[model samples]
Target chain A: MAQQTLEVLQSTDLKPKPDSSELAFGKYFTDHMFMMDYAADKGWQRPRIVPYQPLTMDPSAMVFHYGQTVFEGLKAYRMSDGDIRLFRPEENFKRMNHSSERLSIPPIDEDLMLDYLKELVKLEKEWIPTEPGTSLYIRPMIISTEESLNVAPSNTYTFMIILSPVGSFYKEGINPVGIFVEDEYTRAAPGGTGNAKTAGNYCAAYKAQERATANNKAQVLWLDAIEKKYIEEVGSMNVFFKIDGEIHTPVLNGSILEGITRKSVIELLEHLEMPVQERQISMDEVIAAHEAGTLQEVFGTGTAAVISPVGSLQYKDQDYVVNNGKMGETAKQLYETLIGIQTGRLKDPFGWTVMLEA
Target chain B: MAQQTLEVLQSTDLKPKPDSSELAFGKYFTDHMFMMDYAADKGWQRPRIVPYQPLTMDPSAMVFHYGQTVFEGLKAYRMSDGDIRLFRPEENFKRMNHSSERLSIPPIDEDLMLDYLKELVKLEKEWIPTEPGTSLYIRPMIISTEESLNVAPSNTYTFMIILSPVGSFYKEGINPVGIFVEDEYTRAAPGGTGNAKTAGNYCAAYKAQERATANNKAQVLWLDAIEKKYIEEVGSMNVFFKIDGEIHTPVLNGSILEGITRKSVIELLEHLEMPVQERQISMDEVIAAHEAGTLQEVFGTGTAAVISPVGSLQYKDQDYVVNNGKMGETAKQLYETLIGIQTGRLKDPFGWTVMLEA
Candidate 1:
């Protein structure tokens, strides 16, 4: 860990800027970025804030061939006092390091990373959108920089942070979306790198997502690999269901990412004096509950979508709508409470927000 | 299909060149290189041969985040008469494009790519190690170049060629290596990106490979995902077993990579009036054959190893040795035949070699 200050390099006039209103999710980026390099001789180098520019690398870098990369996605919110704040920044840092360790990449100092992120947000505060549900999306990534074709852990690496402003995850806001129950393909396996936020996990889920999209669905609801019966996740998000007046979610099975939002929701539920359970929930159980009219709601939690109310699930050619295809009351309460905490409207009793210096 | 002439950025100096006899795999590189760019508006740009220099890419490139990349590996052998020849490079080109299509990345023109490669090998001819069982390894890669964080395909890409001088797949001549059967985790799955020669596939195999190494084995032997009983591939290479005087291999089944060497071996076997069967062979069947002394040989085929003999298989706390834990007659014959065809020592009646101008 070093206290070296960030070296800033602003983008020149030639760099095109996108329209704020027309920002299409992650398709647009900010003017400057953060980067740090790791070599066998020198440890993590002096972190720098530079003009968003192309990285100079050998054609045979290990990351280009072995997929030795990991990344984290979180957002910075604009407060009423014109200040930028990150929600649960420590959680993101912890998860990013966990992903890095799993991918054999070097971990960053949590305090150093938080300080650097705060400085980055303070410098690019204007990029924090004021629109409801809109914010500055920050992507922190680490890649193997060793210039060799051998199949081994890299001796050189680079850690970089890039920002992009995005609109609401649920574009229509609080609307219910359909999901295809993915049984044929597993995003990850037990004793595998599934829990790590690595690039391969997302790539593994793409085919199922493509199939889901082709069928006019939003995402794929993944199942456990062993029997393909137990619900694992929604690929990129953790899932929660309401049945018998209790909030239930699949426990951390090492095959699903331990999402920050998932933890936040569980804590929020417990704080609100609601019954919450974390255990393996099988597909048969869910179907039986739906048939018995006991299945109340289903929603997914992620940084992108604070809460996505699942309207219907298509499994084995059978469709089952949740709560008559409406956003559940529990989902609505969780969404509002979470967003309120993120935007500083709620009390900071949980100590989630890390405000950047103005 | 633009025919813009390729710009040549020749290397300024040869630098400190390594001796051919002491060359390590993927450590030493050539001086000149080939590259091209593609964009949604511009399509595939004209190819180029440039000096071997570091490539400049955006820190936020999709390849860094989503692993939107694929690559191919082949070699350029220096014939006795000083001409350079490639073994079935067309197969490599075709497979690379197939992998790109799966990843949603654009493909390169075959003729143009070959032309660029020829130009590069011609300029860097001095780096080709003139030794038996050794050649200059050629690596071609495609990556997303767009500086965006979107999960979808990128609008821009770069295709580049790099050359690395290598010794041989086996350091101790053509000896047989042992394999550890992996039953818990799968390398690839059905209806997934298994058949594609993508980076993610190789990365996914690393953990299994690590397990094999820790267990003092050479490679990981994969099994079918559905039953975990049938033999599949050994990561990068295709598997083959000689049983009851017949050559048998697992069928493609959409989950196995259609290896070029695998196809070549089948053709060569049929040409020699030998029985070659492409069907499922269960692990139990293989073990039973070994116990009954019917399984004579086991080997793997790929561009890197050409023909790698498997001396033994370790599975379920048991060891099954083939041909008394030594290379079998069939393994030796296939290796000699394939190497002969590649090194210009024997006639390539199939017209597989693509010669490059000196």
Candidate 2:
């Protein structure tokens, strides 16, 4: 393992930061950011925490032209004991590196990167919200910095982590939202980068999501590309369905993201003695089950929201309301259990929480 | 028709730039760039030509994270009589807006955008190269600029065009180069963004291209994602084969880009009274044709290279050298005819060339 020497620099002129309650997602940034450089000869260099500033990248930077970038999102929470904690950050770290590998980016020492993250969290512990349902969101991104039009993995790269004080992900709290099933376009393919947390996958879905929003839907649901019959994902989150008294999700078909929150939901469901299965569930099946009165519930899971209960689905000018257009019992239970464990209200049997020093 | 209101900002520090012969691809840029903004309320603003400088974009810009960006590349050439001309520029403009529509980006007025491009080119006439195989490359790009994390098209967007002085596309000149037949990863898929000139499509092919270069190949020969047996593209360019006295290229499937140059090549071949067919050509059939001495020639085409002849194809540890590892007669003829028309050596039969005031 290579030792990382962190260079620290404090901001000279800091603005009067916004209050935690007034904070919006990814809007207000922290004073300092963690950064590191990668090169062919040096592998990965020492990390640094410096004052936040605009990047001086060349116009021909590969990231600007080729979209050779990947990022991860997580949060730091302030516990009742005045200590900061992170929920399964290692999982995020591992998944990020996996995404990097798919984009042909150089891998980093997860332990060293985690240590640097912890140090940043410690230094900016004040940014962590003390209010309920708020925390400091951390964005770790890697971009190609090489100044060339050549379509190749950059010889030089920058990995940086920025912190943002954020409030609730959904403006309407945990109320069920409407989603439209995307028909014309597909997000990822069987052998595509859909499974990886790359920027391209999200960007590809932006247009369809916009159309859905214009049609009065909150999110867009994606189906498999081959047949466009099987359910894939819901934009940024993995979807779950309760059918015939059982919890089920679309299988990891190399085209659906293996969301961290999705995994946690499965574990929580299994712990609660609920039957769960991951399989190729089609749209026809979902519609048939809804009409047969066995659909029970529908929801999505991601780090942004512990669980997003989906109230209705719109497809081809037709609307299907789930469970009377309200949040279901299973979704409510899952959200509360996950949020309780995250906020230290419930005991964590999986050792998924990591407490930080004040 | 939307009247174009050009806002001109005269640059103060315009340098006496270097001559075209010493130009490197995408290195030296023009003094001015054309920009326009798009919003939901205001569809697209009037275009403006301002002094080129680094844009002050928010750190959470969609282009910087989710890769919500698309770009088009074409060039302005200096004719013998000191007049500037654009080769099939309408095709490039039409295709760019098509890409925008598919990516859910707001489309620009093609006529106004063209007028703005012409005005910008007129101002930067000195940047156009007079040397052979050299010209001023124009890059028009659109990016989402909303400083939010929601997976949707930005309510605001920035459309900009920058010019770069470039030499020949190939570093060592266009000699017959070896191509690796890639059977593993794919660049795009059916019902995907492959048809759009999006950044993600190029980035996805980078790793495989790098591996091909590492193995002493100039490019990777892309196969269809399903079964991986049929020829699709050469990744960056569209592939063409001369078998049994006829020209053959892959039909534009949803998984492959419909290159402007590819269309031109097909047109040129037909104009030359040669038989051409756009159909699926399998790898086994290609090998059989090669072994039976029916494979007359093989080449790839794009705006960057015009035409790049293939020396050999490496597939599964086997090498199949085309035409004794040299450029074929058919490939040479096509290259000469295409280059002749672009450089004004041949008659403009299709009125494809648009001359600009120098």
Please give the DockQ score of every candidate, comma-separated: 0.47, 0.55
What clash pairs does model 1 have? A54-B57, A55-B57
Residue range A1-358, candidate 2, lDDT tens digits: 3895788998887766788669878888888889898988998886899887767765567787788888899888887688778989998889989888888888888888888999998988877877788888999888888877666778898888988888876656678989999987788876678888887887788778877888899999998877888999996899999988899999898888899999999998888899579999999999999899999999999888879999999987989999898899999999988888887888899888888777
Q: In model 1 chain A, where is the ten-residue run with the lowest total lDDT?
A: A11-20
Residue A281 lDDT in model 1? 97
Overall local distance difference test of candidate 2: 0.84
Colliding residue pairs in candidate 2: none
Who wins the DockQ comparison? 2
Model 2: residue A230 alpha-carbon error in angstroms: 2.4
| Candidate 1, B1-358: lDDT as tens digits | 6677888877777767687667777887888778888989999886788778898887778788888788888988996689788988888888898887777777777777877778888888877877787899999998887877777778898888999988867767878888999987677766556788777777667667878888889999999766788898985789999998989999998679999899999999999998689998899999999999999999999888999999889999798888988888888898999888888888898998888878
What is model 2's C-alpha RMSD?
A: 2.7
Expressed as tens digits, the lDDT of each residue in A1-358 for candidate 1 is 5677677776664345555578767877778788988987788987988877778888888988988988898999997689677989888889988887767677888889888888787877877887788889998888998988987778998888888888877556578889999988777766567788887676566678877998778889998876899999985889999998999999998888999999999988988899579999999999999999999999999998899899999999899999989999999998998888888777767888887778
What lDDT does candidate 2 reach at residue B80?
A: 62
Reported per model, the fraction of native interface contacts reproduced equals 0.49, 0.49
